[model samples]
Target: MEHPLGVQPQMGLFEGGADVAAAMRTRGLGALACLPDEALLNIMHELAPADLARLACSSRALWAFANHDELWKGFCLDQLEGRWDFQGCWQDTYLLGKQAKGFQPGSRKMRRAAGLQSDLLYTPWLCATCAIDPSWLEVENVDRRSGLSVAEFREQYEIPNKPVILTDVVTKWPAMKKWSRPYLKKAFKGGMTPACLPNCVVRRFDKTFCETAPQLAKDYTVPEVFSDDLFKLLCEARPDWRWLIAGPYKSGSGWHKDPNSTSAWNGVVSGRKKWILYPPHITPPGVRPSCDGADVASPVSIMEWFMSFYEHKASTRCESVGYTPAECILKEGEIMFVPRNWWHIVLNLDECVAVTQNFVSEVTLPHVLSHLRSRSPALVSGCAKEARSGLYDRFVKALKEHRPELLERVAAEEAAKKKRAQEQHKLAGLFKGPEDACPGVNLANGSSAANGSSANGASKPEASGSAAAAQNGTSAGGGFSFGFKL
Candidate 1:
């Protein structure tokens, strides 16, 4: 007989009463049914879903316990990382999960799912990618007890441009409880347009919900550490920069930096995401950037990129200190800080919903302003005009009102930068002509003579401490810095 859910029917535990009695007597134990209901339920809870279902067919006594909604509810909650509560019958949710996992590779229904190119459970790529673990992905975790104050965050992580997973930052967010699948589906009802990544290695569903949906703005607040979001103040011009990211299970984004050079923070409201990060200081060898800094040409997909770059070269390139990319999994209610110029790739472990924002703090504001002034003067000029003020004065005023000490820090840094520039200009005049330029001078120290041309007739990289500053805002061009992404 066919089972309704296609589940294998359970085997009979005691088809013959005499045999059951004989077995019990041989073991010198009473009948299993004689156990109390609480004990039976506890035992049933420990069984896997398949085994529990099989036990239901053994006898009428086990059938009642197996069908209990509480039993299945617990299973669903545990598997979902305790983020979702069953909205209706727990059996229905369990059956849905089971059916989702049951889809055969290349099945018609699986192929038709929007943005779902592969199943999380059945994909050969997922299995292979998760199998190989590399050592360089040693992600640093900073929790509440780490004493991660704003000053320390800037000095330790932000200024150095390193990735760190912040564990306790988003625990009190209103979105943690309010942003559910049902609520989001309703908010985005009639498919009120989302920015879809076209022909991307992984399907990414992005919608600029922060501007379109007023309700979301109320639900999601900026993290305290990144409260100085100058972009939000100027969002009227570049509305496309901010967005809400939602993708189905097995859907995610490819290798890319956050648009513009601004630093970003992504808070997962629910579900899980696997992040692969490459710091700006040490990128994988032979990574070719596309003309548009937004994308890259890779072997196949993001996962394949990792496999080919790290897994295949583990013996050589990966053995170097601080060479491995920072890899970590961000679960429900966790927020990740992605510093400017640091490249990252995201893959959803489940159907995921997250809120991400690009912001400029005092640590990064000078860089953002400098990038904007040079790269897109019109944009910077327009923002200042819109505020009915001068660009520098308005920014300074905003800083004074929100963070007075931060303003002082920016002023000090800018003064130091100007002095360095003047010194470099003075030194560059001393070394004129091809003869002086060709032999690369040791500019490792802060000297303009050290900026001599290389053997290939290209100018040697200067120790311009302001390079990071010049490319610190969200990008407005094909390449982020010097025709390269980051």
Candidate 2:
């Protein structure tokens, strides 16, 4: 006898599984059931998630095959619509989705320390750029008298990187007034001590600490702490804002550029914050001055130096070591926009309560997309493997067509800077001495020479003496003087 698909039949009744095969054949599923598991899986792979899901419901074997994680992973990649990677799509569906439970925030320390060697399973969060876009933030100068509406705000300051202070947005929320230092202390009890503060262990203010701390994570569960009406208003008004609350330390945030793909708005509800911004091309002045000697003499590189200083024992004392940051006291009902890729560090002035969001709007999309195209070609090109395929070819094409000059200029400047640094190091080795040993100090002092005055300009000689004493804790020579302001 012949099988339904016209192949010769096997001799035994149970060869094709009598009961199972007969039932499957009657239901027009004989071919699928008789096929090897691998062959069946290959056929199913061509189906979409929805179609595959429906097929899985047909039988227990089909269910098992469709439920295989490899299939799900492939399904996710296909569903990503070419905009995100498989891992990103999985994260969006399984981690960030509203239905997902016990979602954990990522740790910066684990990320930096592990680098690229970390297992993807252990570190599943998407990169900051993937998580949010800065261009969607809409800012409007809310008239203190006339009420601010969401539409008006979106229309005015929809550009990337410009954050506006919304005067009345959260004024009615009780948490706006209730969340404070005392409240945090009460909420966490003894756990609110300096030892438990965010980035307190490293003595740096890092968001990762807050995300990972057991106590803070538990405290974050306080349901309905924020008013439903307010939450709803924000959700309706700015559907794109990803609310973030950071707290309870004076640790300085790391200096980093906001991913150009996203814009952020931060509001400090209970305390003050100091923001230090450095232009994209320039390192923070303090960092620039200390780079070479600090990089050469210490095992820790210059990058690590700044990281360590900011991460150092969180004390108010070191606050005076550098330029005072621009101060802003964000109280209840105030908002501040942080534009894209602006390098900034934030100091939590008190037990701070704040909310922040990254957004994308129509006006900023062009700029944001352009930035993403330029900065993260690999991300757009899929991953390492696919990047070498058609993705890389597309990237090269785009570079040649749209940005050849810009790319060339960037390469040239990098080469020029490298050459200058090499020359400086050679010169330093030849003239190694106290005054000339560090060109940075000499340059700083020389600029201060014209003033011939103290930092406060109260008294030139006394100020000079104080500075000299502070430098090496000695005024050994009567002629010794320090000219620069602290």
Candidate topping lDDT:
1
How well does each candidate superpose onto the true structure, as a TM-score? 0.54, 0.32
Candidate 1 regions off by >4 Å? Answer: 1-147, 190-204, 211-213, 238-241, 290-295, 312-322, 374-418, 421-449, 461-486
> Candidate 2: lDDT over CA atoms?
0.40
Candidate 2: TM-score? 0.32
| Alpha carbon RMSD to native, model 1 | 17.9
Candidate 1 at 465: error in angstroms?
8.4
- lDDT for each residue of candidate 2 in 430-484, tens digit (9 for 90 to 100): 6444664323323444422333443444334433343343344331111111211
- What's model 1's TM-score? 0.54
Would you list the clashing residue pairs of candidate 1? 260-474, 260-475, 261-473, 261-474, 262-473
Give the Cα lDDT of each candidate.
0.54, 0.40
